[model samples]
Target: MSRAEETADTAAAWIIRRENGDWSDEDQAALDAWLAASDGNKAAYWRLKHSWKEADRIGALGIAAVPTAPRKALARYGMPVALAASLVAAFWIGAIPFLSEPSAPKLVASTYKAGIGERKDVALADGSHVELNTRSVIRAASTSGHRDIWLDEGEAYFEVKHDPRRPFVVHAGARTVTVLGTKFSVRRDGGDVSVSVLEGRVRIDENPAKDGRPASTTTITGGMSAISEGRSTLVTQRSEERVESALAWRDGMLSFDRTTLADAAAEFNRYHRRPVIVTDPGAAGIRIGGTFQASNVEAFARLLRDAYGLHVEIAPDAIKISSQGVTAL
Candidate 1:
């Protein structure tokens, strides 16, 4: 009923879920966040986990443990009440080591972030590599059973190491990308998520009951892309050129093949502080094609002036483009 008892009860529940053998990456991430919240939570979880292991050992030896009442209560409640009781008893008698002397090294989640116009490279413990794009954030951790990554914001490219025994999963928004080994990228824009595979294959799963629709899973191979918005997902095949263009940001370049000025501006704004604003509908509708440096907005604006003959207004916070009384160069 008290805080300590509640913490112990939660810890016991986690142990049961873990031993059930169906524990997921999301579940492990939630447990890690809980343990990192406070020292009391860590102590409670480790104490209960240690005691549960001991209980399993004794049961394997056909020994009659003293916590008979808690064992009988497990059948009715479906929880490890015996382990909880044993943990409490051990604490009272100083029989079990606490957080100061954990049985094994704790696996803490690692977080990586990239600022505006900055890219970061991370080499994971399992030989996996991650490249975070500008203004992106990700959290990763690897256990003996699986590797998990949570894309908190923006975009990231993943070069996953091949390990069939340990599945690699990336959680972005309401969708999950699962794979054994692959080269892919995940981009999160508000409620929409996109997955593009360059090599190998990966499976994308949408969360259940989103927008009143049942969940769905789509497997995409190399040169394939999946875009999920709300509960609807569209998987389409991409040509090699399209795939390269989509991933051009990794090389600090933005590639566009007849992309609209409005759309192109949106993509470039992701990496720069000053935005490109097309005030004229005609200018916004103009289609352009080329590759440009992602961080160089001034050059892009100059191109509109010299090549397109559009009126370019440069302000302190933004670059405004208009097609008023303008003729093609």
Candidate 2:
């Protein structure tokens, strides 16, 4: 089929989904992204919507020759005005009224940062709560129009209150997460950002460029994760156990489930000034699993030396691990 046809079909599907009475915040954000992608997309969506409404009106008058199920039913019994109102409400999910009062949204922005080995809990003006992990930085903003945050470093967990008038958004690395009300977390380590949803749903999209639109979009609900690096984002289903492990840092603990030695050390180093260096690729590949306090780097190193028989070298600023038979420091 042609590109225009495909766009119209997709828009029509969205309209139907909204009419099903279960349309969510994620769906509305998706609709906004679709509209912003291209002017052609907006035209196509409106074209199909107008045509659908016209067809229903003609069927109500028993004038259309269409034999479709909805059209046939409408021909036998006229469409109700209440149904038309409902259709209008459903299809207008993300649309702005042209004739409404012309006003701009008042934007409010603030920045918050946490130090190494320090955790901070923040309560916003909108009743939303944010917990910042060690060495994390975030900016929270709320206005009469919207609410959003920028995760500049490290990780944070959010417990957001329900407010359809204001969406809670997080900008991390190259991605943006939009939600109405949900329990979720966002972790940004350099160029990689991971988003985990614990309750409700959120829409993840590439950050729009200046005077440009988003590059990609996806929706993730509870027990789901979206990982973004560079220009790509991948969504995956996660077990409850894994989700809990991801959020365990809020409790001053780091939980690993069959995580690699290299990865486990990386988590440990996040909370401390000292770094962990893996010298042997073979030892780095060894999988270790357990729960440890975020500050218990010594115990973790001991476990690696005694249980795994890997060499451990300690320095004032860094710790080195290897598989070769070197004496443990």
Candidate 3:
């Protein structure tokens, strides 16, 4: 295949992967290689992908083709109405009796959803990466002019490409994280929203829903984390190690250091069909630190017991962790 053709095919393959919502490391590597090879390759790939999307929209309306209009209005055999009908029919090559034009939402304004206990990786038009965690729903609007991923609900880790002109924005609650380039996780559990920075820098702010409105912008540096409570942005030292622990579900490993028994139990409970019951808030505050397999919930519970000197009560539906008459402190 010619260089242009090869690039187009690569883009097509990536498009298929995206349509399937199965973006893998292999596709990422190909995209990186394509970009490094030549600027022309990127341009050609984008052009074809853009065209393909338009074609998809057309096909969705049950149309095989939309014909071009003739230059200027012209009388054809003194039969103006017939010519108009033919033009309309040509423009809309679909099933007859095409009822009221469906108010189809824009593709990106639309969303791809994942249920609980599910994780999916998707590649956007601008070559950015997003890993949607369990019970997460995200919408991606990918155009050459702009790229956006809006996390409507649940959690997602984003790796946005560097583009000064087109800042990648992730909207989760009132916390809108804007980035030119970075890797970060934005999670909304209930009414609380947390922004954890993994790489590069991100501006976490309260962007306005309407134009001409003021915003509350807070810049959280790398290794730092913030949570939203009410109208203010609260900043605190996000245990770099613990931040990794919070997202360990993505890696199939649960890592924790200096975390509380209560918080740790909560994390594990998300995966458990039964709750990790905590009776006392005091007991839950015991210090904990360790790395363990996330798949084995019982093992993790034992690790907590052995480390924190807490008593573990195993129940059919849940496990309860409480004080052993002493604290780990």
Candidate 3: misplaced stretches above 4 Å? 1-107, 209-214, 236-247, 324-329
Which pairs, if any, clash in model 2?
none
Which digits, one per residue and each the tens of the lDDT, describe model 3 over residues 1-329?
44433444454455445445455445555664554455455554454444542544544445423222210121221324433334323323332222224642223344666665567888777888889876788767755556667676788888888988887888776577888998889998754789888878888887453333577888876777888865678887756765676677678666777888788788777666767887887777776777766557788778767766778888888888777576453
Q: Over the stretch 88-160, how does candidate 2's per-residue lDDT look in tens digits?
A: 3333322334213256332335678899888999998999999999999887777776887978788999999
Return the TM-score for candidate 3, rounded to 2 decimals. Answer: 0.58
lDDT of all predictions: 0.79, 0.73, 0.65
Output the TM-score of candidate 2. 0.64
Error of 2 at 244 (Å): 0.8
For residue 199, model 3's alpha carbon misses the true position, in angstroms, by: 2.4
Candidate 1 minimal-lDDT segment of 10 residues: 67-76
Worst 10 residues of 2 by lDDT: 66-75
In angstroms, how far off is 305's CA in candidate 1? 2.0
Which regions in candidate 1 have their CA more than 4 angstroms from the true location? 4-107, 210-213, 327-329
Clashes of each: 0, 0, 0
Tell me the tens digit of each residue's lDDT in model 1 across 55-87.
644445444443333233333345555444554
